[model samples]
Target: MIHFEISSYNPVLLTNSPLNIGVVETTLDALGERLLVIDRRGKVITQRLVPANNKLAIIVPFEYTVNNNLMCILLDDDAEKDGELVDNVKAAVIDMKNYTPPV
Candidate 1:
């Protein structure tokens, strides 16, 4: 079975490999309101300051591969905010699946 280790203190979690979108969906749903990501310091950093439309999501695709593509959400817990909240976001990765990105 796939396991997604979630932690509120750890802002970013990674999976060893790209998990199936279906699995990702289930994992995310099970997380409920815990998907929110905070800074490494475990502090909620306000990162938005503008207005946005109805769309409230972001997907980034690169290297001509959809499976490896990552999806994320930058949330602003305010009635007035815009753009991604930067460090205040969560990624589709688990602790076991996480890897160090090459520089």
Candidate 2:
């Protein structure tokens, strides 16, 4: 299993009214076939089966709002569990904040 986290280098970005969140692997290993994202309320917001890849960068796209406040819990599903099911450890936590470009 590989550990993962929000990329400290470029955690969150706002552009053209969309929020882009960056997730990176802490270890140099293959990201399994599944990736799970959940909210702070323990609600599974999005879950999908992704192709096996070793790339360190994973970007999650979300529609932006002015009062956006999100806590994203990422899980690496090594067990390949299907939709809305998490069978692996918590890989990372992404804390989101409202974005305001420099004036």
TM per candidate:
0.19, 0.29
lDDT of each: 0.31, 0.39
User: Which residue pairs come into collision in candidate 1?
Assistant: 14-94, 14-97, 14-98, 15-94, 15-97, 15-98, 16-97, 50-82
* Least accurate 10 contiguous residues by lDDT in model 2: 63-72
What's model 2's TM-score? 0.29
What is the number of residue pairs that collide in model 1?
A: 8
**Please, what are the lDDT tens digits per residue for candidate 2 over residues 1-103?**
9999876685565544533343323222344555545544455545545544433333333332222332333345565432333233233323334433222
lDDT of 1 at 27: 23
lDDT of 1 by residue, 1-103 (tens): 9998766575575544554221122122211222332334444322222222232222212221323322333444442444242332333332323333222
Q: Which parts of model 1 are misplaced by more than 4 Å?
A: 1-66, 85-103
Task: List per-candidate RMSD values in Å.
Answer: 17.3, 18.0
